[model samples]
Target: MGVGVFGRNHARVYQELERQGEAVRLVGVVDSDLDRADAVAREFGCRAFGSIEQMLTTHSEVRAASVAAPTVHHLEVARALMQKGVDVLIEKPLAASLAEADELVQLAATHKRIAQAGHLERFNPAVRATIPLLTQPMFFEVHRLSVFTPRSLDVDVVLDLMIHDLDIVLSFANSPVKEVRAVGLPILSGKVDIANVRLEFESGCVANFTASRVSTERVRKLRFFQPQQYVSVDYGRQEVLVFTVGGDGATSGAPTVNPQIKVAKPTVTSEEPLHAELKSFLQAVRQRSTPVVPLEDGRRSLALALDIVAAIREHGKKVGLAGLAKAKS
Candidate 1:
């Protein structure tokens, strides 16, 4: 609803879908800043409003909306929409806290509204391709790095970046986290700019994640090891490379580095993840079916991200990071 950076993208995708003759229409865009909302509305040929109240009142026909407002405002915005019988696709880090997330769950249940979580990576072709290859992931190494940006400074790297990988790993592992250890530092913003986390799941799966907003080059990759297979997923490139041991390597069309090892690239249909996610949300709203990435999944990921943040803070205290920063200053 709020036409900020991510919100603008959501608006654009909705407009594109409308152009493609999707059964949906781009009714309007909303933002706290009226000027920004007006600009986006003009660009997308829709109406604009300064607040959810104004938008909902003006567009009572609005059946569904995307809540791309600030993380702290998610519950408020989604609550208003859901109460009005509007389904919602809420962005990641679903709510500011667990209590708010729980309330969102309850509200959706009470209203019988279709709610989806905006975990964009789940719609990535690479991630989709890796799903079938999942056997029993024992270890994982994930990296999501980007050039520094002032956007999303309201949260630390754990929430801003690492949460994507967290959601993916959590879904892949399908197990409760047994332990978490993390360390992070604020390089350019008051919030954490870089973080490294180790998560051990109840299924004996260990995952190491490194997420940074301050990096020289961008990298988004996840590599995991299963029983006799290793899979690599490139989020940006939308590619999946699977290496299996003791296979014929005949069907893969990829050269075998070793005689016993086989490499196969799963076929992935390239499509904008936002487009796919929105399409899925709309389908769920139409058929009264559960969304692929539901609000419960968002809450689960948010819980883990919050836990990692807490672990990082504890580690900082143990290592006297405050003293080190003071000395350097």
Candidate 2:
């Protein structure tokens, strides 16, 4: 709805879909900033509105819409749309708080709306390919780092960056979290800019996640081990490599273990995750079915991220980081 950075991309993709003869259409763009909205509308060849109410009032044909506004405005925007009988695709970290997330879930149910969560990584080909190979995952090591960016500093790294991995791991573990240990620091922002988290699941699965917005390099990768097998996924590369034990692993051309290990790469059709996500959302809208990533899934990830944030706070308090934070500020 809001034509900010991410919202603009959403508009662009919707426009692309229209050009491709999809059953969807990009009716208009909405932003509180008139100039920004007008600019995006001009770029996408659509009308601009100052608010969601204005858009809905003018364009009643908009059966579905995307809520790409900031995290804080998710509930208000999505609720307004759902109230007006429009399905919506809300951006990640479903809401700022669990109560708001619950409100969204209830609103969707009450309105009979097809609500989708914009967990972009779920559509990543690498992640999709790694799904079927899942077993009793015992351990995980994940790293997501990026150079310092001023965007998304409104939230901590746990929500802004690490939540993607959190959702994926939670789905893989398929068990309740037993314990959480986390520590983070505000490197270049008031909120936690870098974090390390350890999660233990009830099924004896342990996962370690490290996320940073202040880093020298950019890396997005997840590796896990289960039952004498290890799988690695590179989100950026859209690639997956699996290592299986007790096989003819002597093939030296691929990513493999020793002679006793076998390496295989699942077939992954590379495509931009955002495009895939939007296409899937539109398909769900047309079919009147559930989305791949629903509001409940988003809430699950949000709850875990919130827990890690709480753990970070507890660790900070124990280490006397409050004074350090105050002094730094």
Candidate 3:
């Protein structure tokens, strides 16, 4: 079942798959908006529930669910579904707070249900290709700046955009965070719409991240400096450029360090990451296999994002205006 506002996409994708006789089917939908529920139901020829309880009660064959509600509702919906012995795949940011995310993780464990988080970038072919080249990354930088959109006006840029980079960074290491420095500003919106974060890891890895929703052009890029090699990833263009430091075509047998050279600029085909993400979620449920991005992973990412937000808020003290209330004022 697809629950809540943005979840309509989930139902549509399922219906498309069923049209092609795919393994998944559009069993039901649950949305807070009655008109939307009814319209979507008519389009897909599926039942529309006013609440998750009504959906679960009516669809006994619904062994799995995809939770696409707002970030705040993620925990509530996921916990309820897991309690009903249904595997759940939740959208990004996991939950509004880490504490709530942790509760969902615990619920999944107690109920023994497969719980996955929607960090769809994992399915991006560019990201998948860069994963192997990320070995021994000493320095990483990510920037996700896009033209302002009101679709996610409830929160700031960190959770809205940078969480993708945060999730991707964590996958590269097992080291704990040593320190974090951040700052944010609210230009047009009541909340912080742009932010920058610098993270230092215990293993000497450093990552600089920036996100903004008030940009003239859309950009999604990540650059990594791993040892003597440098890799630049342009996710939006689905292209990767790598540079490495090694010996040149010289007869000087002194093994002298050579200038950096451009490595293969691999061409990555463009594909919809969300479709692959949902497909994997269904496959995981069917095979009883571990989720590619598990609930615990979501919990950890939310925890880090919360920590970054706190640091940015505290960062105001450095500029002598400690309590600048921009949002919820």
Candidate 4:
């Protein structure tokens, strides 16, 4: 219901889906800034409203919506929609805090609403392609970097970027987190702009994550090791590469430098992740089924992200970063 950068993209995709005859319509766009909302609605040929209440009052037929509002207003916006019998696809990080996330889960249950978490990576073709290759993932090295932008500065790097990988790894490991160690620093904003985290799962799996919003180059890649396979997923390129050990190289047919290693690039059907995510959300709303990425999974990721943020704060206090910065300033 927000017409900001991410919300605008949602609106555009909805319009695209309608053009492609998806049995959906872009009824309207909402934003605190009326000008922004008006612009987006004009571009998508829909109505514009200044508030969720205004839009809901004007259009009672909006059975489902994408809540791209700021993290802080997630509960407020989603509550208004859900209470009115509208399904929702809430953007990532779910809510600003764990309490809010829990409340969202409860609200969905109480209202019997079809709700989905907006973890775009879960819909990425590369990630989907890598799902079948999962087998005792023991270690992971993931990186998500982007050039500095003023957008999404309201939250730390953990929520802004790392949470995506957190969701993925949490699903892959399928075990409780045993330990969390994290360090972060504010580079371009008051909130953390870069962070590195180490997580150990109860299943004896470990994952290292580095996320930065300030970078010279953009990179979105995840590499992991399983029992006999190492899989690499490039989110930006929408590709999956698998390397199997001591297996006949029948998948790729390309001669490997090591005869013992066989490489296979899984076929990934290219589609905009947002397109797939929204389509799934609509299907869930229509059939009253569980969304692929549900509120529970979102809450799980948010819980871990909050723990990492707390760890980062603890490390900063231990190293006297606050005092050092005060002295420098």
Per-prediction tally of clashes: 0, 0, 0, 0
Per-residue alpha-carbon lDDT of candidate 2 for residues 286-325, written as tens digits (9 for 90 to 100) = 8999999999999999999998888888888889886323
Model 4 poorest 10 in a row by lDDT: 320-329
Q: How do the residues 1-329 of candidate 3 rate in per-residue lDDT, one tens digit apiece?
A: 44445577778777777786778778788877767788888888898888888987788878888888777788888888888899998999898876788788889889988889999888888888887776698898899999987768787778888889999888875688889999888766767788899999999999999999999989999998886688998878878888876665323435555554658777687877777787888889989999999988887887888888778777765675434343421
- Residue pairs with colliding backbones in model 2 are none
For each candidate in turn, the TM-score is: 0.94, 0.94, 0.91, 0.94
RMSD over all Cα atoms, model 3? 2.8
TM-score of 1: 0.94
What are the runs in model 3 whose C-alpha is more than 4 Å off? 1-5, 248-260, 321-329
Please report how far candidate 4 places residue 123 from its true position, in Å. Answer: 0.1
- Looking at model 1, the pairs that clash are none
**Candidate 2 structure, TM-score to reference:** 0.94
Please say which candidate is ahead in lDDT: 3 or 4.
4
Taking the tens digit of each residue's C-alpha lDDT, what string does model 4 give over 1-329?
A: 99898999999999999999998989999999999999999998999999888988899888999999889999999999999999999999999989999999999999999999999999999999988889899999999999998988878899989999999999989999999999888887878888899999999999999999999999999999986778999999999999878745534666556658778998899999999999999899889999999999999999999899888888887897663233110
RMSD of 2: 3.7
lDDT of 2 at 42: 99
Model 3 gets an lDDT of 0.81
Per-residue lDDT of 214-329 in model 1, one digit per residue for the tens? 99999999999987788999999999999877745534656656658778988999999999999999999999999999999999999999888888888887888863233110
Give me the runs in candidate 2 sitting further than 4 Å from their true place: 247-259, 323-329
